[model samples]
Target: MKLFNIVSKTTLTLSLILFSQNVSQTHVYAGVENASPPAVGKTAKDFSLSNLNGKQIKLSGELKKGPVVLLVLRGYPGYQCPLCTRQVGQFITSAAKLKSANATVVMVYPGTAKDLNTRASEFTRNIKLPANFQFLLDPDYIFTNAYGLRWDAKNETAYPSTFVIGTDGKVKFAKISKTHGNRSNVKEVLKALSSSS
Candidate 1:
């Protein structure tokens, strides 16, 4: 009887352990399988990326003045993505509101190094960025990988994500879309910025 009781308890313990492991894995994959944005209170790592004009810009430089909005975009996915184009247009319409809140908006375009300049320039030509806005190129997705936003598999090029960094260089707000269509609109970001202010 004693041996039977011990075996039963051991079996129950193992079952519980397996169940717990499965639950945790499900949460990580389902909740954040595709893209998980940086959480608030995390210090955003600084990076330098080149613009279409071949000018290098650093994240620290933008945050030195005030808050900054960093946007990660999908670049040259065989052709220009319509959803990305729409998102950029939404931001363009709200450029004045973003500037009034003293935030410098920087968009990062990630693609292969080959023909990167042509793709980045083509992207900018389609969007009318504000004076305070800048677009940078992330060839080979180095910056995206560092930020944990690289898709790296399947049809995805890069995960769409946004970060609002405060003057202290910490992430104030972050939103990442898991699917292609579920993005934080410009008004949503503007509301977050206003609330933070």
Candidate 2:
């Protein structure tokens, strides 16, 4: 009876282990699928930005899966940008489509550090982000200037920009808009993402 009890216990343990392994393998994969955003065929410039939640995020770190869509958002330019709001919403709505392609989207919100978090928090309040999407704060225009998107005008911040980068850390496609509303549309970015990956 002791030996029989020992065999049953081992069998139960093995079954539990197998069940756990299956659960782990079938769980939904989350996080950035891994990528870059620079110029087509040019090596992307690496960058790190803090999210409104005070977490640091790196470009190369996100590109582990190959393609990433980068959006440069106008941060608190005297007020929240309506175009940015609309564009972000569109992206969020299309999150499932983007994720299926194994792509990650990174949005950069740039502004002076003063009251940046408060304003950024306000900006993010209404949006629900998916696992593959990250909204990063570019305090004091560090990333804006580095990427040459700083507008440097009164009540103006970074110029709106969109980029598609590949897993090899190369900019596959890049578009910079001089005017506030002259940004890339969702279709174009989606196309770039499919092609880049």
Candidate 3:
């Protein structure tokens, strides 16, 4: 009877452990499975997030001007992403062209709510944003998960993605990189803007 009780308790503990693991993983998988970025021909969903300056920027409001460019960055995923810096630099270098194209560039820096604003400030400390550009923050991965662009991995916040939305609110161009690189180039985004307009 003693041996049977021991075996039963061990089996019960093992079963509980497995059950708990599955329950945790189910939530993660559910989030991933439901995440789908807007397609090129589909209408881009409108969302409002606060910029570093505590000002709220709405997608629909930006689209009211002409076109909107959305850039999703891996925000402070343990550290600033080098690839994101290079990509944003390229866009900054061609700021004049983007302004000429009448496109409002909105970059999303996503991370946990803890110190997100500070991290975003650090990311842009040395850089000057053009008049046509805006840096937005996604606290606790709210916007990231909403757009289905969450990386959901170790030391990762959000996937590096880019989208050009036309005045009609439809996505004209979209590029999502699974890895750190393969980001959308400024020239490509300019072309997409030109055609969209």
lDDT of 3 at 35: 71
- After superposition on all CA atoms, what RMSD does each candidate show versus the true structure? 11.7, 14.1, 7.6
Order of quality (lDDT): 3, 2, 1
- Residue 168 in candidate 3, Cα distance off native in Å: 0.5
Model 2 per-residue lDDT tens digits across residues 1-197: 99999999999999999998888755532211222225578887888888877889999999996588899999898899999999999989999888988889999999889888999999999899999999998888777876777787888998899988888888878898889887887788888877765
Better of 1 and 3 by TM-score: 3
RMSD of 3: 7.6
TM-score (all chains, Cα) for each model: 0.79, 0.79, 0.83
Q: Highest TM-score: which candidate?
A: 3
Residues 95-114, candidate 1, lDDT per residue (tens digit)?
Answer: 89899989888899899898
Cα lDDT, model 2, residue 191: 87
Can you list the residue pairs that collide in candidate 3? Answer: none
Record all residue pairs in model 1 with backbone atoms less than 3 Å apart, i.e. clashing: none
Q: Predict model 1's lDDT versus the native.
A: 0.83
In lDDT terms, which candidate is top? 3
